[model samples]
Target: MASHRRIRSRSTKPSPAVGFTTAALAGVTLLSGQSASAAPGEPSPSIEEVQKKVDDLYRQAGSATQEYNKAKEAATEQRREVDTLLDQAATRADRLNESRRALGTFAAAQYRTGAVAPTAALMFAESPQAYFDQTRLMDRMTDQQQQAVADYEAQRAEAAEQRAEAGERLEELSASQEALRTSKQNVQAKLAEARSLLSRLTAEEKARLEAIEREKAEEARRKAEEKARAEAERAEAERQAAQKAEAACAPETARETAQPPAQDADPGSGTADGGHAAKADKVIDFARAQIGKPYVWGATGPSSYDCSGLTQAAWKAAGVDLPRTTWDQVEVGTRVATQDLLPGDLVFFYDDISHVGIYIGEGMMIHAPKPGANVREESVYSMPIHGSVRPA
Candidate 1:
């Protein structure tokens, strides 16, 4: 758009000439121009003079240089951002590796003990020392084991997410670099022809011009920092609110426990999660009926859905509200630990936190997988999980 302005041309040659204008139009086939000499309108400039003006404009218009410089700087910064993301991904990957080992060890232990069994009611004591083996740990898992699976899956998912973000940034940098290269070449060509004419402009003008650019860049940096700080404050406030709500819920849970044990783990059974028992009951009832449906990306309906979509649809059906995107939905609930996970929890996934799903007790979750995948129930351990929340 900036390049679309109508530039004033060496246009004197095309104007209607004044009285008795006798000028040789070099490329114009004119026999005598006695009758009508579109007399070199306003004093025809000599060809050489016109050439000089053109050369000057070409020299002064460092459009390419300006554009290329901006792109180059952006490319450099993007490289840094990409590098930072890569470093983060690598660190996550290492953690994922460690988690994998832990998961494997746990799996082997269960397998050797022949402790994992479907239709086998499994439970564990509070501590590893108080650990009890199961005939089958698969059907029902302890809160601790469920938490472990959630953590392991979360780490793996986080690593993948980070890698994907870094890869996208790399692509952006590559494209920027290519564009900058092309701009530099164009500027160089114009510079050669325009420099001779560029002398007409005073040094003060050039200096002032550069100063303006510097000011704009400074302004952009200030805006960016301001935005970052604002977002951080918002996140902190949300966290505090979640803490308050959790505190309030604790006593109520204690009261219930004094009367009857909380049966939160409902394996493959919808509407039976203990977590949902006390919260979002209406929403919980709606979501339970959608089990066994295939997932559809971004589709919102009774037939299929991705994680956030399914949650949104169910909540909508219950007259509650939620954001459309998982990232957006993350802020909608009370933050809770995996150890204290309950049914009807809305779990979120992130390295970037761009995905979300609903926890369905017993280490299982319902979600829509990424491209080419369908909506289905999967083990919380089957996918990387980050954290979860409940409607406050």
Candidate 2:
């Protein structure tokens, strides 16, 4: 999530990114000349239609937010890689310089003493083996001198390789940063456009719109709960059937030993007991702690968040590194069917796969909604689901 810092208004600057113009949003078309406080007539657009339009705008903004998150993640990784390469290159260069200085001192010593060494000549010779026999150099050089020659050659090669690697990493870092900046601007523009559309509504219309949202959330919750209950019953029945089958096949003493411990249900924890259960619990804890924070387009923080920013941060807290966008996030972990979704699973939304939320069981999720909204828990079904994934 971005910080709670004030977003610079686009009032003075014209943005080509937004599809809607300010003039086009001057009035609420859904009202159809009806008073803001009164019910709409036959010609007025239904409240449902208006709500759908608003949802679409929010979805568009979410897509841009995902792009921003992806670029941010890439840039961060590139920067770290570049830094490491630079450090390695520096170390290699120092070693190369030391080797050169050592070789120089050896040469100068030979010059002062006027010692014409056969091995030194052989090292510079076109064919070392052929010259070794010609000059009888093989028996002349000590082990330390041979090792020094080898070390010097290795250091020089390492320095050259490190310099090339550093150059490549630096170039990649530059491209990543440029993409990050462009994605940030795109998210801001989409958010600005969404805010513009919502801002055109009267206070009464806004209240009514919120009411519709709540109703949908409640409806989704109900359906999710019903599905959960049915699944539990089916699981329990299967478990009993399996136990009975095992008992029938086993001897009486073995049957008693084969029984597994009974499991307890904790409603608050969304994940089932498995390999990732503990990590998932930590992720859920971090996500819950972020509730009510403001949604800032590029912010990932203790204070505010964008959608992917919040998810990335939460999973990070759990000691798992997740990619920054819903698109990439969806590609991670095992693909889970909608019917098998559990707590700690990341659920994505929309045809473009723009939005995401952390499932907290019972078909509910915690997500950082668009601008003017806060990080909060809502039904996973509140938006059209693209897919789900569980990050270990």
- How accurate locally is residue 159 in candidate 1, as Cα lDDT from 0 to 100? 85
Q: Which regions of candidate 1 deviate over 4 angstroms? A: 1-51, 54-61, 115-143, 194-392
Location of the lowest summed lDDT over 10 successive residues in candidate 1: 18-27
- Choose the strongest candidate by TM-score: 2
What are the per-residue Cα lDDT tens digits for candidate 1 across 1-392? Answer: 11111112222232121100011122113322222222455564443454445434332332343355457667978999998998898889888888777778777766665654433333444544334343234435445566778889999888888888988999999999998888767755654333333333234543443344344434533443444344345546667887888899998977787686756686565433433454445555667677656544435667876566788886676566876656557778678886554556787754445456666544445565432245554444432457777764
What is the TM-score of each predicted model, taking all chains together? 0.33, 0.66
Q: Where in model 2 is the C-alpha error above 4 Å? A: 1-53, 113-154, 204-208, 211-215, 228-282, 298-300, 312-321
List the RMSD of every prediction in angstroms.
Answer: 30.4, 12.4
lDDT of 2 by residue, 1-392 (tens): 01111122223332111111221233335323433432456465555666666667667767777777777777788889888888888888888888777777666654653465666766766896777565543344334456667789999888888888878888888887888788777766765554555655677766667666556655776676676565565566767887888778788657557687556577456343454667777888999999989877778887999888899999999888987777888899888887877668899888999888898765567888666667887767677888899887
Quote the positional error of residue 355 for candidate 1 in Å: 47
What Cα-based lDDT does every candidate model obtain? Answer: 0.55, 0.70
